[model samples]
Target chain A: MMKPGTRLKSAVCDAEIMIIKIAESADLSCGGQLMAEAPERTEGDGDRMHGCLIGKRYVNAEETIEVLCVKSGDGSLYYEGQELMTKDTKKLPSSD
Target chain B: MNIALLLQMAAEACPDRCALTHEGRHYTFSELFAAAQRAAHHFLAAEVKFVALMDVSSPAVPIALMGAAMSGVPYAPINYRLSEAQLTPLLDRISPAYLITGSEIVAEDRSGWVVRSSEEFMSVVSEGEISDLAWHDDPSAVAVQLFTSGTTGEPKAALLRHEHLVSYILGSVEFMGADEAEAALVSVPPYHIAGISAVMSNIYACRHIVQLPNFDPQVWLTLCAEQSVTSAFVVPTMLSRIIETLQQGAMATEALSSIKSIAYGGGKMPVPVIEHALALLPQVNFTNAYGLTETSSTITLLDPDDHRAALEQSDGPIRARLGSVGRPLPAVEIEIRDEHGAVLPPLEAGEIYVRGPQVSGEYEGRSVLDEAGWFPTRDAGYVDDEGYLFLSGRADDVIVRGGENISPGEIEDLLHQHSAISDVAAVGVPSEEWGETIALAVVTAAGQSITEDGLREHIRNHLRSSRVPELIQFVNELPYNETGKLLRREVRAWFAAEAA
Candidate 1:
């Protein structure tokens, strides 16, 4: 999660400025594994099952990051803590 | 006989009054009149008859327009936006005896009589003293010939007489309360009827006119603020851009506040946009002007008060009727007629027939008018109980699917409400089963990802199953002709080819 004082740049306009604060974050899940006191001897043991073990489960979470940024004069361009090259500028051929 | 005489009389009455302005240069009525007199002498020397003008909006346009009138020769202003292929056809039709052009647009074939610039025309006129000539006063004499947009077919030249043009200007000035004190900034192309009418109306009122070579949102906003423009006319597209710019804080409201009225037409204005405009700029008045080239400009105007009242009375239903062009202007008669040419009652949709002094009775080389004297507008619309007229797109634009009629405009309006959709056009595609199925060509907003299924579902939520498009094609932008009107046929063909 982005904390307060962390800057975020606008992905669209590439406007760069400082972010005042981070809005919020969400918990995510990967995959679950069975817990045991020690190493398991067999892959499958009827009595060794923690409950009525059907299959391993995992936690999945979606995250959204929000940050406040300073506004620029150009509506087509938006920036966060640090200005990055915009798509419009990159669309042009490089002189070098 | 000659409308030039009237201009000369007005010039004589107010010689020092500001008549035209271009790029900080101002021309008084007398100066403009003298310039026209000079140009007329040159035309006399060349023995030229019909002339064509191809130039941007500047003092030169009015000078050439009036000079041709004074010289007893009709002038045709060609839209510079037209392709050479389209222009060649029109040039062949008119076969103008002489062509007057600016340095910017020089025709390669100089075989015809050509005047390179207004300065050159003036030079020829300055070589000799101003000659006294009799003004032609015949109302039947052609003053200008404007070509149609050719959306239905090949563009036809609509011949307008001096009387018709003058009557339109007089009626518009009276209805809009335009006077000498008003300053107008015109952004539409000079070739269209709206641009021509705006310039002529300002001249009739003897007001200062600020011309923009083209419509740029930033430039338009800047000029409005800088020039302190009081009144102007624009299409809905330009209005949309202006509002978008304002919302983004790209333009200053203080400058925009100087404008008193903005007349918009050339397609329906979405009610949401209208409401946004009123909320943003409460000081300015909005007018929905409705007309065609055949009518020489506005035939009706829906005032801001009527617009607000319509929205207040009904919910979304009244918003649908906001597409109505509004009540006919004074001295203009509007009638809704059935297929048999019989008049229909109020609120019944039918062919709109209009008759007024400003309406053209015939085309240049063809007879499109009926024996009755009223010109069939070829637009399908009806008058409400309040006498407000509502237009439902062009008659030819109606899509017939499974024996049911649908207006592309209605579907397009609904599609615009989608957050991912930026613009859309609905066209009828060939279908073996239904005879014709609804198809949509859509332009998504920048950085927004939208799939055909997503769009179909979005439309389904707002419309009936039958009303939803069978096919949706995503495009970067919709194809438009020179006049900024959607080319539905081309769009449909593009989608068909893509699917193939």
Candidate 2:
């Protein structure tokens, strides 16, 4: 089972994420393609859309699946072509 | 999932920005990354299983911390204050380690360790040819090991995995959120969990770091001005001393003009001390963080807005939050449960149970997490109707007298309100009449005195008769550890000698 801290790479574009969480048999995709655990195929230069940020977290609408983008990509992250929204951070004081 | 990714990301994002400042030197993010890379080579060359740091705040802290992560070894910071008899065995446990300390001491008991002074280690790592070795990416691997200061037993080795710390950083801190002019001053000692989290969070925020080697209230105020520090973390004891120094009005406001925010934790902050601080430094923002080493630093915080709101209202629910530690972080969930494992409602104090991705309540030999992934923190605290938390002393410190439970925090808070008392600690002592009787070690205010009967009369007026202490001693000061934790175990011993 895919768990938190598991890394996944996009087969279509230069998108990489670490799994914050995943649902049972949830469809995890990036750039409209299913991401893979191994780098079986190198990323290609695709047109950039809905730019994914390197340090941003993405979650589905129901918010069951979550991922943290480790590398900025040319294509946006999605769940079977449905775009996941960026999670807003609740800012707290910088306590050491 | 190595913590090295944090530094690498910062270096790549802003290579030329200032990352650290010590005695008189400033290192850019790129320079710090290079030093870490060099240090990784040292750990690899020596083939050490762990990188142990036994020193105070210095450049070597980051070097060893990041370097150890890059080399796939746990970064264990040992408490150097431990005596030779108590320290030798701990060093042996982390044998084949690269020990970095303030001064090189002869390890008359160990041979596998490579001991080097922090200065020498820094110089050596700077001179070495850079090794481009990649960091180990195992998320479950241990990132840090801290030894808890147990009064009666051996110190427990608490372990934090890479995932635990990364989750905390991701949940609470924003990446590159700090502005170019923003700098954070860190004064906690190396062995403290806050010390490690300070370095981690600052690197991710891309803020400049200024280190205070030794804690002197005057020196801290002077350095804040010289370095243009915007934020800082201080223990309760340190904050009280700084407040005392500021009361003298020895220097102009310009000496502390750069300070913007101050965060305090590591002990129960006396209400009077915090109230005085807020009144004096009206321009400064204050935050109270509460957590344990196993939780990878703070799990809950009282933000500045909450602090202001609490101060604005004197007697309402809003003002009550001043004593509260606020709520849990977004990623964490907290529940107060009784001894029978039944969930308690709001305003009921019980054992604090927490469950989250960042809670790694694992020791060297045993894991404290229950089957449901919940870790029971031995601390005693309760939540308000709105989810704000108020911490009492440790659950173990609760005193039972005549089959009634009494919290020392309630007694200490009332004592703090007394005009003649400056600091106080209420502890349980062995008693024949009752199971345990309350004892007070009170520190009188400057140029003030109060008789034991007068103090008891004051307590009896506000609280119940059971809350009044049977034994009271007007001492000059109470016992606190280096990190500002009140030594209750030692406080309990104070009355023991007199009774004997």
Candidate 3:
């Protein structure tokens, strides 16, 4: 479920998936930096792992997983070069 | 002080007479005066410097405006039609203390403080008898600050004084032959100097003002008939649109029969449109007014007699004077000067300079007035032997391509003569080789078509190759500001974008 102000990322065409919490500092990272910061620890229930992965992405956790990555400006996570979750999954207020 | 005193005198002289009407509600002079007094007291309590008005023409406009003046606070009527980006710059510059609006508008966050609703201000004035408040009689005090359309740059606020306002009303009454009993159906927006001047003149003459929220051709026609409006003012663009509406049978001719004088300004009325309007309404008196915001709306008026006389002269003086804006009003002096500020000979085009009591000396933060007290109008025109002024176009609007000067109006006039062309604007676009190149944007007549090659050929046959537009673009409609004046900067931008 999309929560207000939560951040998510995915690359559906690339078959990749990622989720993250939005943070002010995370905004400076380009697509390369975000793709390189995939977390390593993947142990827990689905929801707990989800929160941990999102938190790791927000903090720029530098760990790699065995998934092809594609980059995009929209905050979408990708796995195996395919989008999994998008910025729309998070109910953030429009910057405009 | 004079305007406040005039209102008080008018109220006392004719308490029972209708002073203003808007949206089916009428206010007598006594009631309107009381409302203005109440608003004055409220402003006094707030101790604000300026009252910003944001609405179209309404009965509340005059009351709040006069009330602000009576309390010695300058009133600025901001054009509500301006985009947020445009409005921001003006709000930052003026920083008005209070905003007076009707129910239709939503106050933006940028407006620092606001006094909403004319009814709210009037209610406060009605709560107490503050009619005896001593009037501030400073002639030099800024009575109103009207913003220009900002077609070229950021809008400049033209500060008009109490004396200037009175002069405009008194002079226009004599020129327009307006009397105290005349009721004017006003359709011009309040933000424009012309609109405000029209309302103030009616008040100064102690005539009834029937205010429309905005210019609607159908509503304007109906009101003129229903209210028995004897006099009215509109820009040439509105006149053209009204004529089109009538031709389409959307409006009836009887609705326009009651109007005595229909004054037009803002731009030149094509000879054909003026002739058609005259033929359609023979009973109505038509006048073409020529002035700027800096001149309190109108400085010269080409009356119907001048129009007929110009047509009668076979030498094209009338057609030439159709390009001319007419002679200066009483107490005003106009001169044509060369680049060096030296006076030019008659019939020679140069910068038009105006000096008079009604003319504003300087703009806020900009000294346009020279040491000799003449303000360069930046308009290129010359006076003929008959003492009539003819405008070529704006001096800035003149294009210099390959070291040769070209007036866009000359090209526009030619395009207007084309049977298949409905409307046209010619602009000079930047070029690497020639510095500037001629470009034309045209709107075609209904059910008519023309190829670019054919248009170029047509132009080449009539004018020099250099004068013919190098580029032609067809558009559904030309971009115009709220007052119907072409947006030259916007047109240039559109051409640039298309080229890219």
Highest DockQ: give the candidate number: 2
The better-scoring model by TM-score among 2 and 3 is 2
Residues B16-65 of candidate 3: C-alpha lDDT, one tens digit per residue: 78888888888888887888888887777776667888766766688778
Alpha-carbon runs more than 4 Å astray in model 3: A1-96, B102-112, B174-181, B313-315
Candidate 1 residue lDDT tens string, B238-297: 877888998999877787867887778876676667777877887776788888888877
For model 1, the superposed segments whose C-alpha errors exceed 4 Å read A1-96, B103-112, B122-128, B175-181, B311-321, B447-451
> Is candidate 1 or 3 superior in lDDT?
3
lDDT of 2 by residue, B451-474 (tens): 999999999999999999999988
TM-score of chain A of each: 0.26, 0.81, 0.18
- TM-score of chain B taken alone, every candidate: 0.92, 0.98, 0.94
Between candidates 1 and 3, the TM-score winner:
3
Worst 10 residues of 1 chain A by lDDT: A87-96
DockQ of 3: 0.00
TM-score of each: 0.78, 0.94, 0.79
